[model samples]
Target: MEETSITAEPGKQEIVISRVFDAPPDLVFKACTDPELISRWWAPESITTTVEKMDTRPGGMWRVTQRDAEGNEYAFHGVYHEVTPERIVDTFEYEAMPGHVLLETETIEDLGGGRTKMTDHLIFQSVEDRDGMLQSGMEEEMTGPMERLAELLQSLKQAAPAR
Candidate 1:
C-alpha cells in the first residue's frame, strides 16, 4: 500500500496530495479521464458513484454523483480549464456548498520503468474553506478512493494484451 502525502500549510489556501503508482503515466491518465474507469474507483466500496458527464477537453463540464446506503446523494461538478495527458486543470464545486469552489491541478509525472507519480493540488477560495475541508475528514476519505484507483490501475495493466 502506498502512503498518500498530504501537505496543508497553515494560513495557506491550498492542499496538495501526492501518491506514486506502479503504472505508467498513460495508464494513470486514462484511468482518471475515462468515465467508466473513474466510476470503478472514484468512491469507496460502500458508496455507489455514477459519472453523469465527463468531457475531457478544455471548457468542458464534468459531473459525478455518489449515493450512499441511506439514499443520500452527493454531487460534484466541475469545469475543465485545461486538459492534457500529463496535466489537468479544473474548477471543482461540491453541490451542497454552492459557491465554495476550488481549482484543482492534477499532474501525472512519468517516473520511467512503468511507474508514475500523481500530484493533486487544490486551491480553495479562502483559507477558511481550506481549513474547513481539512477538518471534515477529507484526508481520511481520500485514502479509500486512491487505494481503489491503484487497484484498478493494476487490474487494467494485467488486462491489457501484450504489445
Candidate 2:
C-alpha cells in the first residue's frame, strides 16, 4: 500500500497533491495521459466523464465533457504546451466560462523502487479566480476522483501478478 498526501496554499493560489503508487513511473504517467484511463476516474465519485478529443502532444488540443448527478454538463478544453512521457503542461479553460483560464503543468517524478510522485501546478490568471474555485468546492470535488485513482492503481498492481 502507498500513502497519499494533499496540500494547498490559499494565499499562493496553489494546490499540491502527492501520492505514491506501487507502479513504475511510465505506467503512472500513462494513466494520466491516456484518455481511457482518465475518464475512468477523472470526475468525482458518481459523476461521469467523456473525452471528446485527446491528442496528448505539444500543440495538440484536448476536450472533455463531464456530467454531474443531476445531468448538468460542463466541458473543458485545453491546448498542450508541452508533453513528455512523464510531464505535461497545458492551458485549460472551461467551455461554459471561457474567460476563466488556467495554466497547468503536471510533472511525474520517478522515485525508484516502483514509486512515482505526481504534482499538478495550476496557475490562474488572478487570485480572485483561484479563490473562487476553492470556494466552489473544488477541493471536495477532487477528493473522490483522487481516491478512485489510487484504487485504480491498486487494482493494476494486483492484476499484474496474474498476467
Candidate 3:
C-alpha cells in the first residue's frame, strides 16, 4: 500500500491524504461508515470514542465523543452532504470549538486486484483554522488509528480460510 499527503493550499489551508489499501473498496468503505468499525479505529490508541449518534445518509447527522487519556472529552458533529457506497461528503464541527467548521470529502475507489484507494480531503473555514488544527496535533492523532485499521484488516485476512 502506498500513501501520500499534500497541502493543496498552504496559505488557504487545505489538507489531502491519499492511501492505497490492500482491501476491496467496499470493505474499506464499510470500515469508514460502520460505527462499530469506526469506534475501533477512529482515534489514536490513547483515546476512546463513543458514538453519540450516527445517521449515515444524505442530510443525516453524526455525533461522536472522544475521551483522551487525561479524561478530557472532545465532541465532533457532522452533517452528511452526500452519501454513496464509494464516497461521502460532510460538514464537520468541533463541539468544543463552535464556529470552527470543516468540509470533508472521502472517496474510495476500487483499484482492482483486491486493492482500494482512499482519498480524504479536508477544507477548513480559514488558513488559521487549518493551522490551528495542525498545531493541535491532528496528524499525530490520526496515525495510530489508521495503523490499527491496517492491523485489523490483516487479521481479518489471516482468519479467513482459503478461497
Best by TM-score: 1
Model 1: CA > 4 A from native: none
> Can you rank all candidates by lDDT, best first?
1, 3, 2
* lDDT top scorer: 1
- Considering TM-score, where higher is better, how would the candidates rank from best to worst? 1, 3, 2
Please give, for residues 98-145, the per-residue lDDT of candidate 3 as tens digits. Answer: 999999999999889888887889999999999899889878765666
What is the Cα-based lDDT of residue 116 in candidate 1?
Answer: 95
lDDT of each: 0.95, 0.82, 0.83
Number of the candidate with higher lDDT, 2 or 3: 3
- Write out the backbone clash pairs for model 3: none
* lDDT score, candidate 1, position 108: 99
lDDT of 1 by residue, 1-163 (tens): 6788899999999999999999989999999999999999988888999999999999999999999999999999999999999999999999999999999999999999999999999999999999999999899878889999999999999999864
Taking every candidate in turn, the Cα RMSD to the unseen true structure, in Å, is: 0.8, 1.9, 1.8
Q: Looking at candidate 1, what is the lDDT of residue 13?
A: 97
| Alpha-carbon TM-score of each model against the true structure | 0.98, 0.90, 0.91
